[model samples]
Target chain A: MRSWKNHVRGELQQRDQTEKLPFIGVFTSLSQMEERFEFRKTCLDDVQSKSLDRGGREVGKDTRLLQLQLRESEHLAEKLSQTVSDLTTVLYLKEAELQYWQSRVSHFRQEALSLAKGSNAMKATLSEFEYTVECQSKELAALRTEQKGINQALEQACREKEELLQRWMEEKREEADRLNKYNAAQERWQRFAKQLKKHLHNARTKEFVPIVTSSWCGEAEMSTSVIQRINNTYRDTTMSKL
Target chain B: MADDKDVLRDVWFGRIPTCFLLNQDEVTEREAEPYYLLLPRVSYLTLVTDKVKKHFHKVIRTDDAEEMWFEYEGTPLKWHYPIGVLFDLHASNTVLPWSITVHFKNFPERDLLHCPSHSVIEAHFMSSIKEADALKHKSQVVNDMQKKDHKQLWMGLQNDKFDQFWAMNRKLMEYPTEDGGFRFIPFRIYQTLSDRPFIQKQFRPVSPEGHVHTLGDLLKEVYPVALPTEGGPKRFQVVIHGIEPLLETPLQWLSEHLSHPDSFLHICVIPVPSD
Candidate 1:
């Protein structure tokens, strides 16, 4: 009995030392210790009862029952130890699955941060493209309006050129007509003067008469004076006509 | 006076033989033959040159042809002038069948007005009539005429319908009996010796002293140089419709009988032929 008590006290000491495990491990170990304590209490009761009976046949039957109880307790202890090992394996697997999931979550977080930075850069580029497009469109519109204005001015200039050409042609025609008339008159006057000069030369040559100074000088002199008067009258008439 | 009505018929029916030959520089599809026509003396050149234009267009290429203009002796013929005036001014001394060059290019833009269509001729004719009426009756006679009446006058000239034109023209010639004649005789004196285009002035058919004005008196007042001095040789021949009327003809009589379709007495003073 003293040896059995010593064994139970050693088991209690081992259970108390094992209480320093993790929270869930400590709880499972404490439950297993309580079951062992109950089993030990039942075994102590059976031993006491057998001591009290003391009859030879009764003691033999009690010894057989105690042996069967001891076999049952050993089987139960083996099954509990297997259950504890299986629970420990499940905890280890669960911890490994948690570690894998935590690593995946961290990887996803890093990817999300990189995606956010890329999106910000894309947004800036998009806004710059939009701003540049707006400026280019504004410049195109201004150029289009300026082109229209230049076209209108070109058309106006063309119209003015046509009008100026018309006016210039009119003035040129008038000047040409005046010049033609002046030339025609000049030609006619030139021809007329040429004819008049020929007429005067012919008249002077025909009036030329040689005077002979022989006897009867007074008669010849009077005849020459009469011829001179006739020639003078002819020259005066020609001059008046001119 | 009854014989004077025949003068109008004679003037209207008067024609001049013209031969149109294409210019040497013009491009032609084939050899262009000369076209001949008897142009009316009273009508405009552009008005009566349709046949001439068609005849020339037959030989000219479509792309090479341009506005048709007439040239005579290197002088661009003014289409706006009456055919007789142009003939007497530039071609009276030439032989029969006055030779005119047909030009399909190089239009004399500086010398001649463009006659793109008959409308241009119509407008010019109507304006000339209006100007004459203004001088004769101060525009009262023309203003009283209906639009159709004016159109009839133009149509008559265009179609060579003398009766149609005379029907509307007699009304314009009318004047008050007490006035003895129109308010003023519209006359244009064209001299070959002067730089002026023509001499136009407001002169009454009768003088204020009640004496009938004469053609000689009009010339003396407007262009003294056109007349000959006393006992001086004749230097200028005052011609009207290819003939010289006696200077003693009354101004009103000339305006009524010798005036052109536009109702203007066109007197061309040319130098006397030396021959």
Candidate 2:
């Protein structure tokens, strides 16, 4: 009986070790435990029948003890199966949680990759914008300098125009003065010409009346040269008086 | 005046039998059949040639096609002009069933305005009406009309509904009885001899002395050469709506009866057909 108890203990220890091996090993060991319990039950039945036949009180007590030990081992196996079921449930839950975390990790990795690509594109765009700004600023500076040059040219042209205008006005003023002087001289010359015309008409009438009166007195033969000399002397006297 | 109302109906219902033939140079998958249509004289060519386009489209490759244009003999037809004006100006003396060559390439940009779509036609038509109103009523009548009324006029012409068009157009033709006629007659005279497109001038329907102006008077004032010299050969024929109306016909009556839907008297002065 002691040896049987020791063997039962050793079987329980082997089951425990098999349970620690793997899930399949635990199932195999469970089947082995069932087989051993059946065998031990058969052996107990045989021992009980024999003890009954012999009508021995101590043998029946031993058989009852063996039955008690077998019952205890069955109780231990039931408890161990409950623990295995609980451990399987915990393992399934842990596997699900690990899968969920792995998927989350992959999603974060994708997000990080996309963010890196976006940043690279943004950097390129920013550099392009900066280059355009630099080119635009340079063009603006060149335009400003060109505008300044044009302004100076325009100012110089304006100054030259003003100078030319002043010179033209002075020349016009001088010409106007000369015209005024010439007009005055022309007026004086006209007056002198009018007086000379009147004097010539008067002298011609006076000389012609005397020549007509002398010709009427039959002085036709009186030398024509002498009349011409008289007329010349009278015109010279009229000019000197003017 | 009662007899004159028939003339307006006759003018409105006038149609010309036209034959549309594809040009020889166009790329076609098969021999294109000629399309025959009774084109409305008062409408535009581009507005009435949808069937012609479809018939030709069946035989022509889509990849080689461009904006469709038309030609007769050799001259590219200007689609902006009324079909009747185009006929009277170019094909007045031609044989029946006016043959026009359809082209899908080589658009004559210098000779014709691009149609693009039906909206362009609408815009052109509306602008013409407004211009005529400006001449007739100082633009008072057209401006006073509602948007739907204007749409009615366009829709009536587009759908070939004479009553619908006339319902809105009658208002544009009204004038004070005491004034005897419109403020000015909107008229354009086209001649084939000159490089000028047309002659447009401000002309009154009545003389200052209250004498009613006649078609002859309008022609004499604007183009004296269009009239036959006394006891001389007729050098030109003054055509309106494919007929030579008597010179003594009152200009006001002609304006009321003979003017196109655009409200303008388009006169074509073509050389006398020698044959």
Candidate 3:
């Protein structure tokens, strides 16, 4: 029994040997120490239980709020899902409209390009026509200038012709005057010739009378006197006729 | 037509000297000189009377008392007889200087229209004037016939109607060639203000059909230098001094319009204003 007791003391003393606490080693009896240890354990157990109860109460409150919030989130998620479906349909329709607009824009672009080409051709033709008009106007101006030169030359020629004509007319008038003078001089010459012929005839008749008188009678003085009287009468008559 | 041909054959023109003796009573011997003139064979004695009046330096008065009539030798020559016929009868051997005397009725002695003595015709002044009137009418007719023939010839020549031209102009071209064909009558063109004297161009004896000759062609031949060098073509104006029938006509057509007794036609060239 003493050995058994010693063994128990040894086991119990073994805890003291292993533990270095002064107060714990100062315990009078093992039962009292055990009672104190049991009391400490009980206190620790109460504290742990109270703490556990407080944590459990808090968790219960959180779990209830979380449950309500989870329900609301589920409802919101369903509404959001419907909105997404509707938005997806709208996106599909808009994509179709966008494709139609893109096709129209392409068509309009082609029309604009063709119109631009036509305008460019028209501009070229208009420029060519304007160039032709400018050339024709220049040609017309040249022709007008040439015509003016020709007109001036013609006027000059006419002036020269007029002067020539005036000179010719003056010469003609002079010729006519000379012809008149010649005719008058010719008339005076003819008159002189006629008078000379008359004189010669009278002289011949007077000589014949003297020859006859001298031949018939040798009375020279009387014959001479009669011939002189006859010559004088003949001269008077001839002068009277003239 | 045959009669016209015969008359053309008989017609002759030559220069003759004419004498006028008007103041025979005042001057015992009127020694007036003679003036030369061209006369046709068919010239009337009335033409002689006119010539005498023209040369006498006396105004020809138609009034009976103041008028003068012509006498050949001592007797009054009848005016109705052609000068050629009278020469054939009275003086066939006489050459030129055909003498004629003028008898004025001595104004206050006796009225020429109312003379009484008609046997000798010394006072038959009124009868002589009437004969001269008839002769003038006949001469006018003959002149008109000749003018018509000339116009026909000219028209035919201008239009190049050779047959008609030769038919009408055969008598005018009566002088035959050695080949027994007729020659074209020679004509001349004289320029007014040109340095060259004259241009002698011959008319075609026979013209081709559809050919026409104008004064413009004649001007081109005569005044080639007057043509335009540049600009529009030049036009020439032709004027004739004595022509009255046609003015500014073709050259050939102008031949018939020449004055009486003119040997050749005279033409004046002028430039027409362009404007």
Candidate 1 per-residue lDDT over residues A108-167, each given as its tens digit: 799889999999999999999999999999999999999999999999999999999999
Which digits, one per residue and each the tens of the lDDT, describe model 2 over residues B144-186? 9999989988987887767567657878888886799999999
The models' CA-based lDDT, in order, is: 0.78, 0.80, 0.45
Candidate 2 docking classification: incorrect
The i-RMS of every model, in angstroms, reads 77.6, 56.6, 95.6
Relative to the unseen true structure, what is the C-alpha lDDT of residue B246 in candidate 3, on a scale of 0 to 100?
26
Looking at candidate 1, what is the lDDT of residue A140?
100
| Model 3: per-residue Cα lDDT over A109-132, one tens digit each | 998999999999999999999999
Ranking by TM-score: 2, 1, 3
Residues B1-275 of candidate 1 have per-residue lDDT tens digits of 11246567766766676778999999888999886666778898888888778778888899998899999989899898898888888877787667999998999898899999999999999999999999888999899999998998998898787766776787777787578999889999887666787899999889989999888999999888989999999999887877677677778877887789999999999999888
Q: Using TM-score as the measure, name the better of candidate 2 and candidate 3.
A: 2
Tens digits of lDDT, candidate 3, B92-207 = 23444456666655533221232232222321322332232232232232243465665554444233233344344333322222222112212344433555645655543223
Candidate 3 versus truth, CA RMSD in Å, comes to 72.3
The all-Cα superposition gives candidate 1 an RMSD in Å to the true structure of 62.8
